[model samples]
Target: MTTKINRHLTWQRMCACMATCAMAIVVACPIAGFASVQTASADDTANTVSTIIVRDGMLSRYTQLGGAQGILRQPLENEHPTANGGAEQRFQGGTLFWNPSLRGSYLVRDGMLSRYTQLGGPAGRLGLPCADELAVPGGASQVFQGGTLFWNPSLRGAYLVRDGMLSKYAAARYEQGPYGLPVSDEYAWNGGARQDFQYGSMFWNVSDWWKYSSQGPYPNLAGVSNLNVAVSIASQRVYIRDGERVLYTMITSTGINDWTPRGTYRINGRGPSFYNRNEAMGARNWVRFIGNFLFHSVPIDSSGNYIVSEAWKLGQPASHGCIRLTVADSQWFYNAIPDGTLVSIW
Candidate 1:
């Protein structure tokens, strides 16, 4: 478990990529640069106090690998100092970084750089670009010793997915689910990493899609899910719909042995509430669809035990005048449907 305070504190830690230094350069050094250097060949912009100096070997490599023929085009700035005694240079396509202990330079560009800069660049937790940005299906990404940055046009912006949080994002199909793309960097939360997405906030330790709100931690199911409902007395089935689109059809148990009034009904309020002749604690998420009859989990006996086995009774006619649903189905019914929505029973 994580402490409540840990979820709120910010740390100055970076990743393994910046543990060393490389080629020299100039910029308002706030973060460590990522790369290595062999020799120097100054550009025309060199000898200027503001532009810093560029190396000939490094420039040659860049020209051949990432210059005119490459996506980066031309150099934007000369080499400069980065955090942790590192050197760096800016190119149209991206930024180049070098550390003293390494033998070569690494380039950072595209969406990866965008996310890094958002994370405070080298000055923040992700010290430097450890690897070149790589292409993937539908988008691009770069791996830092500290974490991974992901960019997909559909997500609208670059975002970080690192640590155990990566597994959580993958579980939700990484930007495909209702959670959408991450909008905020991972922070301490509930003793684990937390990230906010387009649809919801993900807590690595607490849950994949939950946020602390005034009402307490809740799922942000705002953009998805809907509230249309229907029940068939003859087939003993419940149908939940999103407008005219069916969200799900579930087998249910209707008052097989008793009078289950049929007609249109408005769910008045939470069930498990006493009205007419029925009341029980075991019955949960109750919604009254007809007189005294409710759409609720299997009715519990006087002793407070569910009298019907959910697996066995489903898809069959059962229940004591009430519509019987499984625990999960009942919860979904209550949570997804608004109180005043129409519940048609036929």
Candidate 2:
């Protein structure tokens, strides 16, 4: 009886020892067996996990954003080091960028991503994306460390604005301001840079920046029976009309004290340029609506130099007897209006 009891006690001790040894093995390498389990359970969002873990890196963000079920989809490649001690990784849905200076990762995908890559990716002018893509008034945009990427249907793809041009755009209210979304990326022009927007193009040089309204070419107003020009002396504006339908409006400067005749007339002869030595001023692209009265550009000197002081008087009564327009608008008028077009001054 005593021998049998001692053998039973020894068997119990061996079982307890085996159980402790198994526990020690598991504690020593806690993550060793987790990959397979996570892979099998990845379909479930709550249970989805990243097999690879890196502090403040792509893998950690992937798991946090819902792993396989997240918008990032599945990991296509392992996390890799980037320039400046940063890290990045590619996934099925998009690429993840992890900046050491920033807390987490940013995702850039679809058209925005393609444009970013074209602009030089992380090594390019745009650098790494600082934030995810965001919806704007007309289209979508994503912020990068160096600049912002813009995408819309009208743009055909994505474009970016950076540096001084970007500052000018922001001041102008971005896409919501006078200029709409960027239609073209910044490009070298002369010794400076230029970027085109929906309504205008912004130019930047070493010292200053300026904008030009891109009215483009005049539309074909053919076969319209009631095409006419209405000049408003009170509002300092010229309204182009097809019957009562207002097709376009242009800013103009007329004579002070109503020197411009307020009577019905017809557009007659046209000339490229004229200089009045008596007035010591000149103008270009004149379309004569009446004798000694015409539609012409803002006053220039006899040497064909723009009179800055006179040009500044646009949108008010500043001309002597002719209707003064911007050089661009006057040129457009000279090209678009033909002989026998009706003109009414009021």
Candidate 3:
């Protein structure tokens, strides 16, 4: 009618420009895929938040930034990229970390909390140094020589070293004792007091009055009786034993130190006495044993020569502290030690 209505208005303006170019390619393909999925979901919600409260709330709201007064908004803070990125902060105010399975690396700074390690990567080095100062107290047990702190006086516990020594739960807790005796190959007598013997090489056996019964291993004779007989300040050289056989061979001289007085006294009195040098000492012949001390013999040196000598000082520790023997070794130590014998002295 007007050409067919202007050709139906150009054909409806080409069909409304082809429906506005198909709605501009369907809204630019979803706004460029929703702006690349909203920029990858806001970079994954800023990497899942907490980088130590986002670096302490961005250094407490940027006291300054680009100019660098407070700096670090995110140079790095609690990173941990896969398992190796390593980071966990608090910096100028304590707590810092790295620890990729103890490949180690930490820092707390002025409030103390140091640690470092890395010599080969994958976290492998650090045999020492790296806390950047403040070591002092013998510089960490001298770079781990004292082995990183210890006290263990037999597991009273308090140890912590690593790789160098002690750390199997502190050497398995503790249980130590028996350190005094052990050297027996079987002579079976056990008696103990460090196998007692008064004078060197070992010998003790005496009976009759100045008692101390048995002990003898003389010059390696090894007749082993465990030992415990000691007397020398003149209790008449008694050391005796003729039964179990151990004998240091000698006896007879007692009583004179102001009439016998020096503490330990025994052997009350035995038989056979006669030569009497004012009762004994010099040939009381055979006065088996007696107390207040006496097994006599005196005048050993102005040489009136009354022989039977092992001569332990001739004024002989001055008698009454008696033990002077020689009359046939005091009749074989009163016929070989008997009555309750056990003597000890300083």
> Going through the candidates in order, what is the number of backbone clashes in each?
26, 0, 34
What residue runs in model 2 are displaced by over 4 Å at the alpha carbon? Answer: 1-60, 206-283, 286-299, 308-329, 337-346
- lDDT tens readout by residue for model 3, 85-146: 45444433443444445444443333122322212222433232223233322222112212
State the TM-score for model 3. 0.17
The residue-by-residue lDDT of candidate 1 on 271-311, one tens digit each, is: 55232234433466688765567787655555655554443
Tens digit of per-residue lDDT, candidate 2, span 1-346: 1121111222223222221231121111112223222222324332232243233356567667785568876455567877656678887688899876776698889999888888778888878778889999999889888998889776579989889999988987788765668888888875798887664566787222211213334456887679899898876777678987756666678998889999999999999999999999989889999998999988889789888788767667988879988777788889888888889898
Tell me the spans in candidate 1 whose CA falls farther than 4 Å from its real position.
Answer: 1-57, 64-66, 99-104, 167-181, 187-193, 197-201, 207-346
Measured by TM-score, how close is model 1 to the native structure?
Answer: 0.46
Q: Using TM-score, give the best candidate's number.
A: 2
The residue ranges of model 3 lying beyond 4 angstroms of the native Cα positions read 1-85, 98-160, 164-169, 172-346
**Best of the two (1, 2) by lDDT:** 2
